[model samples]
Target chain A: MEPIKNDILDYLKDNSFMDTNIGLEDNDSLTQNGIMDSIGLLELMDYICEKYAIEVPEDMLTPENFDSLQGITNLIVKLVK
Target chain B: MSRIVCKKCVLDSDMPGIDINEESGLCHFCETYVPFSAQEKSDYLEKMEELFREYGGRGNYDVVFALSGGKDSSYTLHKLKNEYPFLKVLAVQFDNGFISDNAVENAKKMCELTGSDYFKLTMENEVLYETFRKAAESRDAFPRLAKYRASDICNTCISIIKQKLIEEAIVQDAPFIMFAFTPGQSPNPIIPLKANFIRWSRSIFEKQLQKIGVEDKDEKFLIKNEVIESMGKEGPRMLHPLCLWDYNEGQILESLVEIGWNPPDLNDSNSTNCTLNSFACQNHLEKYGIHPYAFDIAGIVRSGDMSREEGLEKLHQALSQPLIEEAAKKLNCR
Candidate 1:
């Protein structure tokens, strides 16, 4: 996994009720798999913004940017650059 | 099986996912807990004032307040109006078919005192009853932590409230929507209602309602797709002022009572609005071996907002069996 993806996964594990038994794939939809709910997503967004010191643009708040590890990693990389 | 309660909070070993360290006598949540610092609290209060100033008098109604007619919500409305009289608020109280008559009256009374419009949001009685019943019967429909935050029935109700209020905010062109969530009920004080997030949440909740066997073809429990499309990049923001404010349950009740808010005569100690709450709690306890309010109350205790003894007293307060049986009978799920 990319370092950013690893960090995101670590944060989820630490804070969320993600079932480690079922494990997770990079592309698996977090909301669909019950890894994160709406409130959890808000919390994750806050974490990303604070950790990366990047204010996410409103238009970038798509599932393609947040619903999966790969998507989140890509979004962070795009923002960091 | 032996039961061990947390020394710091009201959580105990009987609750799922609650692990008490025998040596420490503290649950994992309490052990790893961090309270908001004085600086952080001040910052939050400043941010809230900024939000109020920016969104206060922009339109016919600047806010869609989710008033549950509970002590927290009533007090929140009273305080908000007192502090920001410029705000045009439409207080919405959801009538979930099981809400006490007194709750409706209290909601109306608070709105009258606050000089805000009061709107009672009601759905078909049969549909609401079926939804609550399905929520009670459905298992693992929500994630474990979400379940810990509230009973399945309450989670269902709150989701509906969120979706409906978001819709109300968008449709009414309000810049803000407010919910009187206790500090323990949610972590964030402000959540921007981005279009993507709203769409995402709508889809997830639709799936949840479907899982509970509710045919939401009418988008009964969701934001309409057109509303999502119309919102584009962003919509109204959500604020939980209770999370930022100094929270004291005793003071809140006293403040509300001074403003003519009457507490409903209910056996449930945790809630002040819905009569179905006791039934929901009893059902949750029976189903999951957990008192649904344990996590929320525990957070309050951990924050030192409430004494551990008070938290335990609230947690161990006997649920109203008569109310539970009545609700169950009404839902035909007994």
Candidate 2:
């Protein structure tokens, strides 16, 4: 698994809402599926900061980068790069 | 009042008398939640409990409640104490520099009556008044206005109070910190926030705070490190017990009165136990074009606790006074 994908999955598990099997390509629309909300997005941002040591800029917290597991992984890759 | 549907939720504008822009079919409240959920109550509680356990509760004191001496907080404090006698309460009050004497009395009386420990933190009137003036004069004042609707001073006052309560919770090693928030004001259910989360959330408002030129460092006076460090691994959980149960305003008021919580005379135009409330409501309407009380009152009405006409009449009465010169003077607005 990609490092970003692993970190995102770890975060989801830490929050107690996701399992290890959930992956980037496996229907990752958490918001549309009701697995997350704005607050969840925020918690995700915090998790990314702690786990990946990435500081997500305020503008970067958009739906395109955070609405799904794929989006979150993409965001992590972008921020880490 | 035209019906306003939250472009996101099942909430309607008329459902809470929220002022809506007809063309957009949205209200200010809905706009703030565009990135959020319908705020399920059950999920919130479960999240809060999970946080409570994760934070570790050993050697932790009971919850620290921000008691406004109002019906909601007072009732919440009473309920928590009654249900969980093991729960110790640290009641903290923010002296807005102009609290009604009756409110002071109520705060004292209720603490004594409930046998709960209490503390009152008074902010510098000069500094508080100046912040209020600046916030009131700012264009983005509407968000602050919507929250309190009491006065410009109130936005400043609550910021201080919130900081103090968090600090106190940490200092006292309290595992949980609770407020008396109802649904419309802040839609979230119970929250377990770490010191870092609190810091991050406050950072979101840094721009707003900078607009008023209140130094970020000054936040330390309200939020102390000792408290933060003392706050165990589990950050404090902010709970609003009122949301957990179906409660009517009348039932709450009656229960409070039964417990010796007296309502200040409604005839006192300039005062109530919550002196800042009327002014908060007035300023809210002035800036936001909606009554600050509208959200709470509308919630009560929607819950069938009050009649729409009664809510409107109460709102009208609350807003009846022209902005008081004394209030502006206290706020140092010329």
The best candidate by TM-score is: 1
Tell me the tens digit of each residue's lDDT in model 1 across A1-81.
Answer: 378988998888767755555678899998877778888888899999999999888888888888999999989988989
Candidate 1 achieves a global lDDT of 0.86
The residue pairs found clashing in candidate 1 are none
Error of 2 at B9 (Å): 14
Give stretches of model 2 more than 4 Å off. A1-81, B1-60, B141-153, B220-222, B225-233, B266-272, B318-323
> What is the TM-score of each predicted model, taking all chains together?
0.95, 0.67
Q: Tens digits of per-residue lDDT for model 2 on A6-31?
A: 66766665442343454435445655
Residue A36's lDDT within candidate 2 is 50
Residue B158's lDDT in candidate 1:
94
Residue B330, model 2: Cα distance from true site in angstroms = 1.7
Task: Output the number of the DockQ-best candidate.
Answer: 1
